[model samples]
Target: MAAPEPSSPAPDLPLLDEHRIAIDAPRDRVWAGLCRWSDTLGIGDRHPLGLLLGTQPRRGFERVELVPERVLGFAGRHRFSRYRLTFELAEITPVRTQVTARSNAEFPRLRGRAYHALVVGSGAHVVSVRRMLNSIRRESLKD
Candidate 1:
């Protein structure tokens, strides 16, 4: 895995951010599930934020790197602003996976920053992301 880049100003938020969760699933299963989420959720061309904002889908792709049962990285871009959302994973047990997602972008001023922050930092957005990932993990375990 590559070292994390320093956090930068998110155009929508005042602070760069990181969010993480642990799932009870084998690393391979977890990794595979994440790779397939775009098609599974019918968001193949849509930026995640677009879906969150109730806009139509746009073009984007999830970039996934696999390192067996030890590590995995999942990243996708927000189409309009090109913000990157990245998730890094570490296996803590045979069936436990720890994952962190970081949000980063370059915003010029406070208004833009606040706007982006509001959208990204909202509780509803956070919960939606968590639920989506958890659902992916659950589905992956079934195969």
Candidate 2:
């Protein structure tokens, strides 16, 4: 799959959450850290959601796009929702990079709306995503 363009709209899916962080590390290092951390979380390129999706290695996410040290993306679906998460990296200076994590998702039907309220409205998704971004910053800055 291809990574969705950053400036482009997410089509029918709405923007669920977005977070940005500036890391005091090289682009390459941040890219590596992103891969490693996402992999360890078992959500890298695996379809680990369930049988409705596929029995893959990681969690519910599958890496749908990659662009070396620049862009990384993932998409997955369950009974209630279809979603995408994209991480874009831009070099601010030789020693710094800005990382933005964006999530777009569509929740269908009554059940799906309830699920959305439970996760998004409760702010759990924001906390989790922010923590993940921070973890990448920490890991990337490591020696």
Candidate 3:
């Protein structure tokens, strides 16, 4: 069967956003560290949303969708959206790994666009998601 369609409109924001970094450590070491839920815990400090949502404590995986060297998907909560965020490992080479996050919530529209336009943007949400992605990358590297 084909995948189901999304209910909401394609987020007016960038969806498949990504960042690539060359960690000082080897890919396996980085992958090992990245794979752990503990590594992700409290890493929100770098995220722009983190500043607003605060740090999330380490919680064990309630469900494990996929696990292996090449890909890993799981459900967990973050500070802003209380939804399951999936991290997909796209590429894992000896030198580096590529990962992406996918989630859709009205929080961005609420706290981000709607709030900003009415209060800050005049009618548009000006929050920079690129900055958020960069923050995630920085936090990921610290481990």
Candidate 4:
């Protein structure tokens, strides 16, 4: 019998969305906030369409890459969108960090493409990104 093909860890995807924000918090503090916030995505995020369709916040993706307080990345499939989200943190001062969030994604079929167009490409993704940044800022400032 022939051996089966090795499974790929993640599919190579195309760039879809990217955004950045500066946080007045230390890199380590922001990193800690990010880790905690990632697990709480679905708890309070509720899109109007999502509510109409009963879409729940997705489970957190596994951290595919990590560089301590500098970089963090994750890739996964949500609904029909296969994508990656990476966070890059640069320290600008003793208590400030510039953070960038980059997203790369691929919609394999018509349904996925439509979902991305309606939800992501229509500027909702931007809102979502900003909310995420605010969450990080809030968490990082906590004692």
Candidate 5:
């Protein structure tokens, strides 16, 4: 099925992070890794639950946009937070590509604010995002 409409924050949401990596593979190969959930949890944008809306916690993000090798975006929210993650690709060379992962999110209410504090304020989120980008780079380079 086609991905849902492009996803973005409500403008009031904060910019969580913007991480970039240069990969040896071409954009197409890198794009494949963007679509992979296990391979890149940072870009988990294709799970069925991501699109299904309910009060139940969601394990993944629904695809909000796809532009071939240029962009892949998704948004999903659980009880504590609502967030959007986007991977933007740029061709650096015939055999190389640059991928940037940008995240925007908001944690509302008292509990949500606390959840954000524990997760985002602890530096864990940044570390995990970097690790995820590296994982994608490694996965894409594999033969």
Candidate 6:
């Protein structure tokens, strides 16, 4: 079955959104892609988004957790949206890996519900992550 539509934060559980995707590639290859992508976000890298989002265009995220090819985790704060993001990657098999992206956002007090109503309904978060996973897969397949 197809995925369900994205919805507003659960009234009971605000401030979080999680998304995951599995890539059809070996762990090492996927890891290389992830590292390459993140490297391009660091200072002296060529990615536009990194320069825009980073304070000094250096390593934008804190390496909260890492375990070589098996796991990688990062935490970062966004300047424009005032949101905290956590990224997690885990190797599920020799030929597959799972990527999870979580976002912690705060909307103005008493306006969270309305903000979620507008943002969650748009499914932008899911689409972005899906594209990220696809890009990782494609990059991993490269020589």
State the displacement of the C-alpha of residue 118, model 2, in Å, after optimal TM-score superposition. Answer: 0.3
Residues 1-143 of candidate 5: C-alpha lDDT, one tens digit per residue: 46566544343468988999999999888878766743334222446544443322244556677777788777767777888877898999978999898988888899888978988999888997798789878777767
lDDT of each: 0.55, 0.78, 0.42, 0.70, 0.74, 0.58
TM-score of 2: 0.80
Put down candidate 6 lDDT per residue, 1-143, tens digits, no spaces.
Answer: 23223222222223567777788887788878876765543344456666665532234444544556654544443333334444566778878878776666655554545655556658866676567667766777788
lDDT of 3 at 32: 61
Better of 3 and 6 by TM-score: 6
Residue 3 of candidate 6: its Cα lDDT? 24
Query: In each prediction, how many residue pairs overlap at the backbone (N, C-alpha, C within less than 3 A)?
Result: 5, 1, 0, 0, 0, 0
Q: TM-scores for all candidates? A: 0.59, 0.80, 0.39, 0.75, 0.78, 0.58
Model 5 regions lying over 4 Å from their true place: 7-12, 37-57
Instruction: Return the top candidate by TM-score.
Output: 2
Candidate 6 structure, TM-score to reference: 0.58
Per-residue error (Å), model 1, residue 30: 1.0
Q: Is candidate 1 or candidate 2 better by TM-score?
A: 2
lDDT of 3 by residue, 6-108 (tens): 2223333233233344444455554465555424433433566555544232342223344554444333334333333345554455555665555433335
Candidate no. 4 TM-score: 0.75
Q: Which stretches of candidate 3 lie over 4 Å from their true place?
A: 1-26, 37-64, 74-82, 107-143
Candidate 6 shows a clash count of: 0
Q: What order do candidates take by TM-score, descending?
A: 2, 5, 4, 1, 6, 3
**Candidate whose lDDT is highest:** 2
- Flag the better candidate by TM-score, 4 or 5: 5
Q: Which ranges of candidate 1 are over 4 A from the true structure?
A: 1-15, 40-57, 60-80, 109-111
What ranges in model 2 sit over 4 Å off? 1-12, 42-58
